[model samples]
Target: MKIRRLASQIVLPILMVASTPALLHAAPLEPTRGGEGGRIIRVTTLAKDGPGSLKAAVEAKGKRIIVFEVGGVIDLQRTILNIDEPFLTIAGQTAPSPGITIVRGGIDLKGHDVKISHIRVMTGVDGQAKLSGWEADAFSTVAAHNVIVEHCSFFWAIDENMSTSGPRFNGKTVKEWRAATSHDVLFRENLAAEGLADASHPKGEHSKGTLIHDNATGITLYRNVYAHNMERSPLVKGGAQVLMVNNMIFDPGHRAVHYNLMNLEWAGHDYVTGEITAVGNVMRAGNSTAPGLPFLTLGGDGDLAWYSKDNINVDRWGNPAPMFGRYGVTKAKLIEKDSPMASLGGLDVMPAKDLETSLLASVGARPWDRAPDDIRVLFFVAEGRGEIIDDEKVVGGYPHPSPTAAPFVDKDWNLKTMEPKSGVYPGQKGGAQEKLSARDEAMRENAK
Candidate 1:
């Protein structure tokens, strides 16, 4: 099958002219007065006490609007002190330096209406063993409602060997622990990439009530991408109620999308009743050393397990086909153009009445719908060449660039979901004759 390739590049310039004054002068967002109205505060320093200064300014202003105006690097070694009020807006400069990296003691939020934009919250680490003070986690939230975390990045590093071997690989060491718990949170147009080492620690964790809308959620993950992410499986113990759409999740280690029952308890306790909708996502699995199954469903074992389908699809070769342990999918369908998933009985879930109505009323197509099945999807490898190859072929063809390369696919084909199946529910079985009849009809139609 032909694989679809997309070239990943840093498009924005690293440096740009400072325009804080101009932005401030242009137009204010309807400034409010006193506690009832919101005020704007700018933080433009790179001191270890930068967060302290910012917090003081916010308190002094007595307004909720707080902007991180510092254009240069601000080392966040516990910079953000506390976030107690609502209607807070923290915006950074457009230019990029080291950006804002919070190590330990992230921002704790209370109330609602918090907005953060144009910043990179990275965890700086020295080596796999010696984590930088920032690797502890740059920013965290707690009981914050209607929060918006947009146009930002979250990164960390991990040990290469330790991630693959030891208890970490078995998904035991990585536990679910978020610095914060946000409701109605929006994480849009951001990038969550892996640092130098395996940065997949703190795995098997969940971020509740998060809307991962239109972002490069997981990009450039070399070694342990979601190896031990407890949050990976929404039905699992650490899993949370998350709306993940229009994102790219690439894992060179284990399955890119892992659903485990171990993390589902948290969902029940938190009263999170939303199902994980893996729609319009691009997931690329690891190469040689990497397991073929790019997606795995652990726990939820037997007949009571959960499954994914409907508008939810996967590439045939790059990742292993979806695996079901005990649970099964409900009203789910999988599709792939010229791939195995395509042949698997399923139907398209898009172009529904609701989707068309929403698209017509919106400003434009939803970010997640950019590469809709109707659009032409393209893939470009680092080598600047395009070809279809199996996992083994792709891995063998490209010399492992780094030990990390052991998990990423270098040369591979590109495939798209075409002619999505129509109206098929999960957990239903069909006889071989029925399957053959359907295939024959599709073939005849295509021939015509």
Candidate 2:
């Protein structure tokens, strides 16, 4: 599990640099042009909310792209930043070295057509009492659509680290429920880890990962890293259509990926069977993981129609682990299929064996300027040394990097995607360096 090469040294997929037509065709799961022809709005200060604050820029009227002139943590004072405006793009990559980090709070995406990348969200306990009902997700989409969240780091959330969810039963019909909830969203190449257990959540010891709430549709989680969290690396609830592809989950407490639909929650509405397509995923046990924990756990009163293929589940010693389990009083039906109902026709999905190498090299925000906490977490995953924690204090709490600011030059980047037109990113010295392909890497390894 050791990452033999640095992230910058690995050859990333084309999606990392530019979008292709195939990638774009990944809809209704793919995100649309988010704030792509919008006016540029610069966040010139690190204030929580003011004239030049990130909050102000997000709350601004009309379609806009929010770029940062300052770098460092923006302490929300335990408050959440709600993005209620639509068609917004937050280009955190435009920030100076050691890119933008939001701490002591979270971001709630309630708007449609939003794209955010290269940002870190570290929501610690903020001195709140344990089991006192204080909870926050590092990032979440609430009944929003056409959104993309990439290359972000989420840590220390009292609830799920990152999630796409909304009102479970928004309308009487399943189609209405799907429309009203979060859907058509993409979460790619992010790191979701170290949720705080037994700290501030009212439900004691609740340190989950991601929760795709009931009835949400067209959700795709691709190439993300989920580590050191208790469970729900994502839990797909009833009637949701989800595609979990090429993701890595390490050190889960009790479960890795699961599905459940409690009878009480869907008392009035009939239970619609959920659909899950899990492909090319890797789940490894770690220190805090439960013994003999199944890679996919099915629970509750209803059944789930799932398809799993090319997924690897192993224990700490690299021993093979169980693949499936059930956890409810009633005998819930488990529908296993040979092929998926829906196809990831346009996305690039690698084999499970190649997943760790790609993930270790690219997951998380600002790989070129990773925070010490993120660096440690990634290293721990490589060396297999970290564990699920009860508090963020165990890992030195939130960071307070000395704030740095620099002027942004809009001409240097493509305003639509915020990518550098000159092929040189912020932290790079010159043109992008050459990367080793998989074959070349394998040859080098053999030589060693």
TM-score, every prediction: 0.47, 0.90
lDDT of 2 by residue, 77-123 (tens): 98999999998988888898778999999999999999888899999
Clashing pairs in 2: none
Query: Which residue segments of model 1 deviate by more than 4 Å?
Result: 1-37, 50-52, 55-62, 78-81, 93-111, 127-135, 157-181, 195-239, 261-274, 287-289, 300-320, 323-448
- Model 1 per-residue lDDT tens digits across residues 348-370: 12322122112111111111121
* Each candidate: RMSD: 18.6, 6.4
| Total clashing pairs in model 2 | 0
